[model samples]
Target: MTETRKQLLQELAAKNGTPLFVVDHEVLRNNFKEFREKLPDVQPYFAVKANSNPEIIKTMFDLGSSFDVASIYEFKLIYKNIETWPDKERQDFIWDKIIYANTIKPFKVLTKLNPYKILVTFDNIEELKKIKQRAPDVGLILRIRVPNTGSMVELSSKFGAHPGEAVDLIAEAIGMGLDVEGISFHVGSQCNNFDNYLQGLNFTHSILKEVALRNFEIGFTDKEGKKKKVLDIGGGFPVKYTPDVKSFSALAKKLNLEIKRLFGKDNIQVIAEPGRFMVATACTLVTKIIGKSIRDGKTCYYLDDGVYHTFSGQVYDHQHYPLHAFKDGELKLCATFGPTCDAFDTISLADELPEDLQIDDLLYAENIGAYTLASATDFNGFPVAKVAHINRENI
Candidate 1:
């Protein structure tokens, strides 16, 4: 970070008060642009569950990005942007620009989503039956289970259908008078293992080929009347939170090459749900040291934001955001804790910082945009951090 940016963060913290989460819209745009540049063939659907801030969604909408919503609320958040468009335009937007990616959705949510006829994902026969009964008009994407090895958060254990059962499920969906648009899978969140993606692509390709052999036609026609099969390589695009985490460029190169080798001749419309990759590094959190103490000959600093608030990502995301002091001084190993009463609120016990820092001094963490604020809670009566955006004018 430059001195100018650090100074700006301090100014924002002072102006907005402590425990402030700052989002730089410029960074968000740059990240999205980079994703597009790297994977030109893949359509990025910003996963709203990562950071569902309205402004972030609006910025993404302005950038002509699609969305991947997990719930009724997130669906509404994206729909709010196009609520004023003409009836056809609104329906078209929902069909082309949004995907309800959650494999298991509530029956009420299915009923609510029926009118839009948007694309939704399913992994089991029960979900297919629910969709057929409640929202038969919606498009279906079969989510198959794949390897999630070496990912920060493993999701395959909870979601996705067995690869052996994938074909059967697709056949069942088609047999039920439903339109099976395509196949989808997630490697995992913050994935470092590139093989997982390759395996997922292979699985999807095999499944589609088998579906064709069975004489089952999948896909839908777009507004341009082009029949395209949707290939949703679900989210798991890794973010470089640490030096050891592999670069996205390397993954994109592998993906581009493998996608072409596997499905280049197929009429596949590739889309990706990228959550952490887009907003993880575009925001920062500034907190104030509320108290100082010494135990076991080690210094401990308590901040206004804790595990229940902005640092919640540490617990939920399995990632760390080391805090840094604005003032320069001799560095020493120290401990940091949140304002909460529970010992579980500890931020870091081995933070390296200046021991001479006093209470009310400001500290900040970078690349905390994803999963942190979205999972924050108001435990111990401490309110979540106040969000302030920069460079938000004119998109």
Candidate 2:
């Protein structure tokens, strides 16, 4: 964390009390602008599931950012905000700024949201049939499986259809009278393997080539009415949590080169669904030590918030947030845990902290905006972390 961020967090903690999440809107805007500058041609659809805070959504919406919604509630959230925009801007939001990216969705959600005419993704024929019956006119993107060996959270095993099976899925969609827009695949979350994305892009390119060879005009309409298609590169772009991790700009450079090499200078409508990368570094979680004990010849410091709160990403995303303990005493190895009855609420099994840490001592966790509060639960009587928003001017 920079000195600026630390001071900002200190101010927020002082004002809002402990167990607070401080979101800097300036950081969020800067992150999005950097992403756009790095990949100028790729349209970004912010994945709302990462941190669905309405303030964050409103910030992104004000920046003219698109959204990738997974559930009806998410769509409603974005819809509720974007509805307040100007009439023309609201129409654009209704038509083009959103994509329903969840392959498996509730039937009621599909039936009710079909009138919005937004883009959606599917993996199997059953999903296709459901979409056709419930939401026929919406644009469709086929979700294909790709390599995800090095990712922390492997999504391929659970989602995405095999490449061999996807060919028929496209053909079936065309046969059943569906709007086949393009192809999409997720390499995995926190994916460090650039090869996985290259492989997925190549697979999508080949599928488009095959469809073109068969004279199918669904996904191949270029800007000049020739040959081009949309490619939804599902998000897995890594953020710099630790020094060993590859920076976002480095990965973006590699992916951009591969995209140019594979598709040439064609006017392909490329888009990315970025969740973690968008908001991970934009917020910090501040929690205070409530109690401490020594067990099994080691120190254990309990925090007011844990896996059931803002640090939920530790259990869900397999993340070890960078922790900073505030004290001048000698350093000692300590274990951090949430203030919960469950033994599994440990935040870090092995962490270093100041030996003189007291009950009110605070610990700041950085890069915790994603998959944290969004997946948090009130398992015991403990409450969710209160969010404190810092606008650009304020930050």
Best model number under lDDT: 1
Q: Give lDDT tens digits, candidate 2, residues 67-154.
A: 9999999999989976667876676566568989999977898898788768899999999999988999788989999999898889
Clashing pairs in 2: none
Model 2 deviation from native, Cα RMSD in Å: 2.2
Leading candidate by TM-score: 1
Clashes by residue pair, model 1: none
Error of 1 at 215 (Å): 0.4
- After superposition, the stretches of candidate 1 with alpha carbons farther than 4 Å from their true spots are none
State the lDDT of candidate 1 residue by residue for 1-395, as single tens digits.
88999999999988999799999999999999999999999999999999999999999999989999999999999999999999989988998889999999989999999999699999999999999999999999999999999989999999999988988898898899999999899999999999999999999999888888988889999778888899999899998888999999999999999999999998899999999999999999999999999999999999999999999999999989999999999989999999999999999999999999999999999999999999999998999999999999775
Q: Residue 263 deviation, candidate 2, in Å? A: 1.5
Q: For model 2, where is the 10-residue window of minimal lDDT?
A: 219-228
With candidate 1 superimposed using the best TM-score fit, by how many Å does residue 357's alpha carbon deviate from the native?
A: 0.5
| Cα RMSD for candidates in order | 0.8, 2.2
lDDT of the structure predicted as candidate 1: 0.94
